[model samples]
Target: MRDVAREAGVALRTVSRVVNGESNVNAEMAGRVHSTIARLGYRPDERARQLRRGSSQTIGAALRGTGGMWEHTAEHTARAAGFMTLAASTEDDPALYAQVIESLCQRRVDGLMVEPIGAATPYLVAEVEAGLPVVAVDRPLEDVPADSVVSDNAGGIRAAVEHLLARGHREIAYIGDSERIYTGRLRAEAFRSCLQEAGLAVEDASVTTGEAGPEMVADALDRMRRCSAPPTALVTGNNVISWQVLRQLGPAIGELAVFCFDSLENAELLAHPVSTVNQDLEGLGRTAVDLLLARLAEPERERQHIILPVSLSIRASSEVPPPPRARRRRAHKAQAPSS
Candidate 1:
């Protein structure tokens, strides 16, 4: 504190006032103190301060991946609620996720917002029971009783399938992430259900889920196309797979009507504007923060799950069916007449 006073050329008391966020300090003095603190790389001992204040007033967010609109909104919302935000990426690794959560628990964050990865997180239940409010985002953590804010994965898939089927497509296929993940599983299952409801056969070759690599997408495409009656349309489970499938198949994309389960930034820029089910990702982020803050205020409140609806952005992609080779071949056979 004395060093900060000396660096800012202010009295020790003035520096203390600024560090403690006392608004009485003049703006000029506060600015100088903050600038000096920045130049000197100064960070207050939050643990010591929390001990004196009886609460840390900080929240930690453990996410599968980081740096999206959702993370930005959550951090901003927490700040607006007078809580410091701490975030860490779990990289979708179970052990790493547990480690990060444990570290945050040790810091005594007021609460946690997690984008759970694995199917189970039994270890976190104890933390919740111990009064650490937790809210899950994007997907629910199986077997864990926590408030969650997620987009409607099944409904989104249903919208995509119904749109394609209404467009006169009998054969529709899907390519997505591995079903080990919650979102992927819901989407794949919903798509299969939609096909069955329409009295259409659920061809195993039509549903492919694995790593979103070029080879994986290419192989799936090849398998779907090799069937006796290839799919006339395709629905990609997510934006990542959507682009990979589009790029891998290239001109063949025109041959198959496409509907992506998630929207992409440059979707409209393509030669053919791609249709998509736009998830309310930003809403997901804001609602997550809202739920976490609510849980922090009332830790004993019943857990809540908010599922945001997804909408379809109809574009040229799924509106017009391309000329499949099989159709052209059948046309040629018809033209040949008597054999």
Candidate 2:
């Protein structure tokens, strides 16, 4: 502080105010202080200051994927609220999840917002009891108590099913993530229910899940098409599965009505504009931060779970019906006698 004050030709208190981003510091003085700090390669001792104040004013985020828009949005929202943010990817690994959470706790962050990867987190119970506010995003923590923000997975599946059904699609197959995952399970189950309600068969080969490689997705498509009654439409569980399915389906993609549970980045630009059940990612990110901050302010507040709605964005792919030739081929194959 003293070095910065001397270099910027300002009092130590002025340097402190500028470093803390206090409104009382004039713009010109603050600029000078920032420039001097940059030239001197001086970084604030945030930990030491936090210890003195008994508040770290920082938030940690544990996300499912390696990196994406969710992490960026959450970090930006927290920073805008005057809080420092740190993030790590769990990659759906239980050990990694524990390690990341422990590291963040060691740093004494004010709270955490995590896209939970596994079923149980009994370890987090003690941490929450110790006054660390934890908010779960995308999926809720089963073993530990925490606030949560999630898109309506079941509702999204219902919307997708409705969209395809309205387009006269009866035989709709699904390719999804492993049902062991929360989001995947909800979506797959919802799809099955929708089919059953419409008196359509949920063929074993028509609803495939577990892995999402190109080969795996291609195999699912082949299985559905090879069946005695091929599906005329399809629904994908999430963005990763959706993209792979689209790639594997290729020129044949337009032959079937397709709806994905989650929206993709370049969906609108695809050769066949992909219809999707769109989750409000930005809203989910902002809500997680707001929930964590609220819990921090009132430690005694009840645990909250926010489920945002999803909407279907129609496009060329989902609204289209099966090609006449494709339908005829399937009908003739079904009617043919066994050799």
Best by lDDT: 1
The stretch of ten residues in a row with the least summed lDDT in candidate 1 is 328-337
lDDT of 1 by residue, 140-188 (tens): 9787789999999999999989999888888888999899888999999
* lDDT (Cα atoms) of all candidates against the true structure: 0.87, 0.86
Q: Write the per-residue lDDT of candidate 2 for residues 163-189, one digit (tens) a residue.
A: 788778777899998888888888889
Best by TM-score, which number? 2
Q: TM-score for all predictions?
A: 0.84, 0.87
* Candidate 1 clash figure, as a count: 0
Q: After superposition, how far is residue 305 of candidate 2 from its true place, in Å?
A: 0.7
Clashes of 2: 0
- Residue 262 CA displacement from its true place in model 1, Å: 1.4
